[model samples]
Target: MRAIATPGGLPISDPAALVDVEVEAPQALPHDLVVRVEAVSVNPVDSKVRLSANPSDTPRILGYDAAGTVTAVGQEVSGFAVGDEVYYAGAIDRPGSNADYQAVDHRIAAHKPTTLSFADAAALPLTALTAMEALEDLFHVGANSEGTLLVLGGAGGVGSIMIQLAKRLTSLRVIATASRPETAAWAREMGADEVANHHDLGAEVLRIVPEGVDYVLSTHSEGQIGAFAEIVKPLGHIAAIDDGNLNLSPLKPKRISWHWEFMFSRSLFQTPDIAVQGRMLADLATMVDAGEIRTTATQYIEDFTAAGIREAHRRIESHGTQGKIVVTR
Candidate 1:
């Protein structure tokens, strides 16, 4: 099998950051699927791991989002077969999808959306799961949910899908934050009812909804916690996916609750309900096929080699990409 991997903690500009190597094919473990990877997408976690994970004698594979065909299934797997087409964000503890073949736990994998191509399907798994879990599992928003919801960093992969999911699944009025005109337009295209400038988050959101919003989804929460506290209504909820040294005192006075959403937590911990990821993904596929949701793949790269993976990492590190970037074999 051909794979691309990082030597460890090297800058993207270094040619050694990602390298092409030939490796033995993986075999399915009990409750796992050995997939022949067709397409993969790069996420911020890929870059973070590349820089922070320890150096190893054997280079580490870093991709997470993948769409592929199952070449073999574990003895205990029931829903998938050898010929099934599946998509998933493979567990962070395992070797990743930037390879010709990968072994992933079948409990977290689902059949790809029938309406999308491999490139498009590859872009949905990680981001869609994050959005779905944050909205439904964390915030507990549903069809009966009402009030305004604000989405921070609305043009990025997770935010793009979050906007669409919130609109289709809940009655909450959606406000997405985007500093650039192009990103603002993209946010609206994804079903945001209003667009606020992320550069001036508090003022922008206040102008649109003077009473403050009921919920806040912070995709990039580095330095905006204060603004989030200011714009959220009392007793409202805020769910964030990024890691930062956050100060919670600001939200304390307002009685606003803050929650952290890490999509990899369930798979990483082997939770009892780990199969919910597969189930949610299956539901998302049905929605995609029904035209209720759309893929967020804005940029596509056809090369699945080391150089291509490096370029994809560079783009993700740029911090300005509008949607998901897919690299197909």
Candidate 2:
């Protein structure tokens, strides 16, 4: 199998930061599926891990979002068999999806949407998992909703998918924040009832949704959250994926409920509830197949060559991408 890995913490440049290497083919575990990876998507976590989670003496693989075909299934695995198409955002704690073959826990994987291509399917897992975690696990706000919500970075990977989910799954009115004209338009196209600028986040949101929002999902900088406090409903909930030195003292007056969404939590700890990721992903797949949701793979750069992957990373770092950026083999 072919792979790209880093020996030390993720290197930013040169020195084969993400060098090509050949590794032994992975075997299906008792409850695992050996997938022949066809396409993978890059997320902020990919770069973050590249910069932070490198192995000391050996190269660490970096990827989490993948779509592929099951080549083999463990004896203990049920419900899926050889040649079953699947897509999953794997555990961050495990070796990633950036390879020719990967062994994934069947409990945390799902059948891919019959309508989407491998690259498009790959783009859904990570971002969808994050959004689902934020809404279903952390804040538990998507179901049976009766309040207005604002997705602070709704044009990004997680936010892009999140906007649609809120529209289709909940009764909540969604207002998404996007700084640029293009991004704002993109958000509206994705089902956002309204759009505001993240550049002037506080002012823009207030102008459109003056009464304050019931839920605020900040996908951008934590440093900008103080002003966000001004627009949150008095008893609203707030969730953020980007962590910085956030000074949340201002939120005291509002009595806001804060939450953090990391899709990897269940997988990282090997918790008894790890199967939730698999089940939730399956839910998303059903929605996709039913045409209730759309793929967020806005860009695709072919061939998993090291340079191509680097360029994909570079684009993500630029913060100008509309949705997910995929690298395919």
lDDT of 1 by residue, 1-329 (tens): 89999989899999999999988899889999999999999999999999997878799988999999999988999989888999999899999999999999999999999999999999999998998998889889899999999998889998999999999889999999999899999999999999999888999999999999999988788788789788999999999888888888889988999999999999999999999999989999999999999999999998999999999999999998999999998
Where does candidate 2 have its weakest 10-residue lDDT segment?
A: 7-16
lDDT by residue (14-96, candidate 2, tens digit) is 65667788888888889889999999999988888887764666788888999999999998998898999999988777788
Q: What are the TM-scores, per candidate, against the unseen true structure?
A: 0.98, 0.95
How well does candidate 1 score on lDDT at residue 127?
Answer: 92
Model 2, residue pairs in steric clash: 10-50
Q: How many backbone clashes does candidate 2 have?
A: 1
lDDT, candidate 1, residue 62? 83
Regions of model 2 farther than 4 Å from truth: 9-11
Show the lowest summed lDDT stretch of 10 residues, model 1.
219-228
Best by lDDT: 1
Error of 2 at 88 (Å): 0.2
